[model samples]
Structure formats: structure tokens, C-alpha cells
Target: MPRLRYIEESEKTPQARAMIESAHKTGAPDPRVVSIMTRSEIGSAWVELWNKVLYEGVLPHKLKEMCRIQISVAHQCGYCSTVRSNVAKAEGLTEAMIEDLFRYETSPHFTPREKAALRYANLFKQGEQAIDKDEVYRDLAKHFTDEEIIELGQLCAQTDGVGKFVKSLNVISWEEACEINPKLTEARAEAAE
Candidate 1:
């Protein structure tokens, strides 16, 4: 169980309730994610920024998720890794693509552009912000628009922000994502071997 009491579905405000309902229809919303989010309207606000307001506005969902996966790896944030892995699956990213995230340099699953983006995410996290600032932009320009660059950057930042929180909460690794869903654990394990 989480350390704090989350906002139960029964007590969710009308607006949040609607969001929960909507997210459920699209992505198979985990009640725990919603509950924790509702526990703090602030948390819900952050999620809204990602799910509704910012994600599509800033970056292509696939690229954004790819960047997030890279950051989760860089931070050693298993929570972020697992969650984004699920998201990647939902977005039609292949299993090889997901596994390759951890071993991109040696995996053919990553395209050159994809590797560039992942490297950019890793480099940005490593504090060499200026070295490839324009290089990534150039690489991305080949695939996405200027508006997309800003959006992608924002998605990377949000993932890092969430990763930091998940890490601080000691929710770093999940055995079946802390049992948020049993099937996920089983499926993940089956995929592993």
C-alpha cells in the first residue's frame, strides 16, 4: 500500500472522476495511478499536463515515450521503466524495441534516429546539455517539426520529474509493478525468459 491515503474513486471530484473515466476507456487506467493522482489535486494536475494538455501539444507520443524510456533507464527508475514499458506496448512499440531500450547501442531494434534521440535524452540527463543541443535538434528536424522539439523536451522533463518522485517514494522497482496488476507481473516475467 502507498504510504498515504489516496483519493478513493468514491470520493473523486466530478472533474477528476470524468478524467478517470476517460483515461480508463483509452488506456486501461490503473485505479492506483488515479487514486494516487487524486490524493493530491497537484498530482492530478501534473498528470493532466501530460495526458491532456502537453503530450500531443509538444511531441509525437511515440517519440515522447521513447525519450521517457531512455530517461527511466538513465535514472535507474524501475517504476518509470515499467510504467513506460507498458505505455510503449500500448503504443505498438515491439517487445524487442522495449528490451532494446536497455541495450540500444548493441540492438538493431533502435534506428539511427531513435538512438540519437535516446542518446540525447541520456546526455541531457548526464549534464552535457550544450554538447549535442543542436545535434539532436538537427536529427529530430529530419523527422519532426519545430513544435515537436519543444513538446519532446517537455515530455522528457515530465518523465524525469515523475522518475524523481517515484524514486524518492522508494517505488523504484516493482515486482509486478508492486502488484498494481497481477497479470502485468506474469506477462513481464514470461517475456523475460
Candidate 2:
């Protein structure tokens, strides 16, 4: 069971319901990663925009997954790291490769591009240190685009966005995130009253 509640199907407004339904629902389409934001379609705007950059963006799944997992770990967020692991698996990354994310520098599973991306993620998450290394940009640019870089930047930023709710709600595991997260039903209950 989750520490929070799952949104009920009926409780969702038609638009919000459709948005969630149409998303990539393999295990859980989009958990918003420990979000307590409204379950209304209003929030779907941000979701859709994200999908546009992620699912529809120029970056391939492998590259995107690499960045996602790397940033999630840099933030020390177990939830995001696990979610990225699953996504990477679906996209063809192996368990070894996923596990290697914590020590990717020495892992042979990563491609040059992937290693470069991971290095970029570490630097990106490291903040001010990024400015100290002008050399980092050359490495990052070989594997990413200005547009793709922007997408990676947003994904990195998500750690903090999701982290706030994750820590506040004490969300530590993906195994029971759905059962614990605030569900559509909960939002409806709140709106109706």
C-alpha cells in the first residue's frame, strides 16, 4: 500500500481523465513523481508540454533515459532513480547498465555518448562547478543539442520539483507509489466538498 492514495478513474474530470489515460501507461503512465498537485486537467498542461519534449522530442529514448537516471541519482532521489531505471529497461538498457548509473564512470555498458551524457548530468547537477569547467561543454555538445540540452535541463530540474513533494510526503519507494499517492478520487472528493 502507498503512503498516499491513488486517483480514482471516475473522479477525474473528462479532460484530465483522458490526458492520464492517453499517456504512456505501461506500469504507471505518469506519476508526476510524488506530486500532490491538483488531479484536474489543469495540471495536464504541464504534463502535455513535458510529453512533447520527452516522447516527441528529438532526443532518443536511450539518451533521454541516461540523462534521467543520472540526474535522479545526482539528487539522491531514490524514487526518480527507480522510475528512470524502469523506463531505461523498457527502452533496452540492461539491469547492469541501470545499476552502473551510480558508478557509470567505470561501467563498460555505457556508450561514449551515454558516458558523455552522464558526465554532463553530474556536472549539471553539481551547479556552480559547471562554470569552472569550460571543457565540459565540449563533451556535452558532442552528444546533445541546444534543444535536447534544454530538455535534459528540464529533466534535471524535475528532481527538485518532484523531490519537494517526495520528501514532504516521505515517498521513498516506487513499488507502492500508486497506492500511496493522491489519486483522482481524492482530488474529486476535495473538489466536490
Candidate 1 lDDT over 47-162, as tens digits, reads 67767533356454665676776676566554565564344466677745765665666678777767767766666666545435677677778866777666666666776776
Q: Name the runs in model 2 displaced over 4 angstroms.
A: 1-10, 22-24, 28-42, 84-87, 128-133, 173-193
What overall lDDT, based on C-alpha atoms, would model 1 receive against the true structure? Answer: 0.60
lDDT of 1 at 7: 70
The 0-to-1 C-alpha lDDT of every candidate, in the order given, reads 0.60, 0.56
Residue-pair clashes per candidate, as listed?
1, 9
**TM, every model:** 0.72, 0.69
Model 2 over residues 17-87: C-alpha lDDT tens digits?
A: 55555543632224543132325354556666655545556767666666665555445444554554344
For candidate 1, the TM-score is: 0.72
- How many pairs in model 2 have backbone atoms within 3 A of each other, for residues 3 or more apart or on separate chains, i.e. clashes? 9
Off by over 4 Å in 1: 22-30, 53-55, 84-91, 128-133, 171-193
